[model samples]
Target: MKRGILLIAAMTANVLLSAARADEAAVRAEIVARLPESVGNIAITPDNQLIFSHHPFFSPEIRVAKLTSPTTFQPFPSAEWNTPRKGTYQYLDNVLGLRSDENGVVWIIDMGFRTNITPKLVGWNTRSDRLERIYYMPDPVTRTGSQPQDIVIDQKHRKFYIADENIGPGGDGSHAAIIIIDMDTGRARRVLDGDRSTIPEDLPITVDGKDLTVSAKDGKPSIIKVGCDGITMDVRSEWVYFAPLSGRSIYRVRVADLNDEKLTPPELSAKVERYSDKPNNGGLSIDYAGNLYLTAVESKLVGVIGADRKYSTYLSDAEMVWSDGITASADGYMYVSASQISAAAMFHGGKGENKAPYLIYRFKPLAAGYVSR
Candidate 1:
């Protein structure tokens, strides 16, 4: 009887493992669009129009673009907005993160690192094809080296939560934080600055058997570290999920607590809950069922943290190099951008190994998700 019991237990475990593999295999990545330059992030408008940012790392002349065909794109909103003019904040200086809301407003975050301009949020109305609003993030709200890369729009609360990685010019990821903006009043404030939750772990990220590094101030190679890079909200907009690009864990806090002005910094910090362990990641998006999907950069895969707080591989591809941004669409698919950042020249003795035709791929999620998120 003891031998029979052990045999049954082993067989049961094998069956469970097989089922898990089959589930992952069912979700395959399908190519959505191909571009000559690397893509930083993606957002699909309510009308199903796809929009993305040409990564600032390469200094592309066309900063923001809309896909007109699978292999072609044009300056988004207008060519004038993408053009930079001296002593003016009217144009997009640098952009990385953007999202479309339920009402068809596409919001883009301009980090302004390229020209030292004031970092700001630009919102364009897709339906009207015109400018809607701009919220300037001046000093005290944004410090030197503030690279606000990702954004989470809460239409229900009329607020915008931005993830500032603090990894640019004068930044070394030491002072990462989340900036909150009031949609109605255009008021913005920095929160959780330098908190343990907003900072990167000391862990070094390795990709393709090589350590990802960049030139330090001393002109020596140093492992790249980024803090508070990805941010997202659940379907209910009750909790804000976030993590560092070089972090080993994901953390979140109640949306109410974060917006409550009465709470002190210590009080707000105490409310943050460590959600789950994660690999080094870039962007985050959540499904209606509360499963948080992450762009697992180092592993060349997309990972999901279920409502039960368990992390698992949802989909993967050997060609999926440095997946940077991800967003759920109304068509019941999750879109991802393969930025190929690790292969960029900066990490390879200034000899760029990045190939053209950077890709955007999509896969089905466990549950339906909003397009704006």
Candidate 2:
């Protein structure tokens, strides 16, 4: 009789475990906002306000914007900040990556690709509705084709890690690396330049049965390869995770080693660990439990690499054309943007195929997440 009871208990436990797994796999993405312009990235202020960048690939009139309603938005910070003034670096030129810290300060990375000026990081205090700071990234720190796309803010250590995907004019993923900024001193350094882990793997990114290609300077067709695109820091700020947009793996290094100026390039490179295999991804975020969330651009889905280093699909939708940027919100949900980059005119041979009403989606996460991370 005892043996039979034990068998029944085991069966009940198995059924409960299976049900929990099924519930987790059933998480669905719900549309939070729809806009006429494609969204480049997404961030949420402490007060739960949605802020996003208008994808620069299409040369948007408004560089950054904040949601006024579910379907409407206005230029963020101000309209003047989005307008380009000749010979001045005060306005936002081209912006992509942005994130809001716990204090409600939204840090924006302006590529400066439009006017060919110095790239910079701009911080706007959402609470005060004022400009907080601006850090210039000049020649040596940024290269000829340096497009600093994504940023990871480590407030605990007063540092900012930026992923520079050298896909600009003279950049062809050859000069890709991480730019470490010391928030305290306003100093920056380019580390792991040309490292294998930071560069793209020789792979083609295909979308909707077509390989994405770009025209070279000589009018030759070449695969569009991007490097060091996605970047995120753990809740503890111990490690910064990053991966190339055209590569199939994620890599990370200790924040301590990256901040140690005494460490040589080779030494820093040696410290990088191949975290997990992933699809070609665009953005990254993390939960407090250490699970890394990735915007799997190629698959039209959001995937999570758990603390155990296993990757699994978290949420998927047919409308998620190019899941560009993702962030963990204070509301216990993860938000992502579908930029529809594959339908852009440049990829479709100069005839913009993207439909209006690009989407921003949110779904519950496995664990609670930090807003600053």
Candidate 3:
């Protein structure tokens, strides 16, 4: 009978839908690593070697590490650099921004806030397992209210683009800008000071169905503000894209304009463009085919902005909370770390509630070749 056939077709469609979702879940994201609490950043080299950084905002142990296996990480370079008691001469202070270039070199931006330190860059040759170079930021540059949060390396041009989140000691984030460093000459420049694109307009950061706020001295929840947290460079190394963790928009500018010292900040600001509307996110990554990946912090999703500037949800999982650093690897995988920052004790009264075994996830990128590695 016609009615019986209709029922069978409906049942078949339901089965097919279930199968499709199961297939999607199969490759949603593989749990590549686990930690005790949270990590600030994650980078994978072209050879699929993993490197991660510990955010100075929390514990200072293991400022940088290399994944020997899925769950084990060895302090990258050595334990001295990760230990505060090792004396400040040849050790790392604070490292947040991390990147692995195509040449298998890992670059770290040490904010240098430990003891009395100088902000600098430490490059490690992964192939040789040795420190390659160190470039210290001049006093004038670091004094310009620098709070480097993330970095993007332009290997083709031998330059580095750093995002200054600008959150001060008192938890104020009014100052935000991009710092450019020349790898060849060790010269650094801060651009777009106080510009609209660099500054994060006050906005609520919601996570796990609750707005992330600051805990007052009296245990009251207050608004939390952050600026210019994530950044990335295009495939051709011609453009840079960035976004604020508390913001819902993505911005971009030409590298040519950023490198030109003759132009004033105001003039350079004019060259920056508001690229697209996005969700609150912690990291931005671009693939070689020009697709931009955003780590959606609130919705527990990974959003993608295609060449058309249209936003779409690429992956969604309940486990991805406070999805922090994201890296598009040349191996066709995009890796993300779930720091669960909003659940930390500082924001939840005096008691910390961060659960152990924090997770890192990775999925195949939309297209092939990634920008850096």
Across residues 74-190, which tens digit of lDDT does each residue of candidate 3 receive?
A: 898789777766435577778878888877888888887755577888888889888888878766666544678688988778889888887744435566778888989988887
User: How many steric clashes does model 1 contain?
Assistant: 0
Candidate 2: misplaced stretches above 4 Å? 1-24
lDDT of 2: 0.87
Supply candidate 2's per-residue lDDT for 290.
69
TM-score of 1: 0.93
Error of 2 at 72 (Å): 0.2
Instruction: Output candidate 3 Cα RMSD.
Output: 9.0
TM agreement with the true structure for every prediction: 0.93, 0.93, 0.88
Report the alpha-carbon TM-score of model 3 versus the true structure.
Answer: 0.88
Question: Higher TM-score: candidate 2 or 3?
Answer: 2
Q: After the best TM-score superposition of candidate 3, give how far the Cα of residue 100 lies from its true spot, in angstroms.
A: 0.8
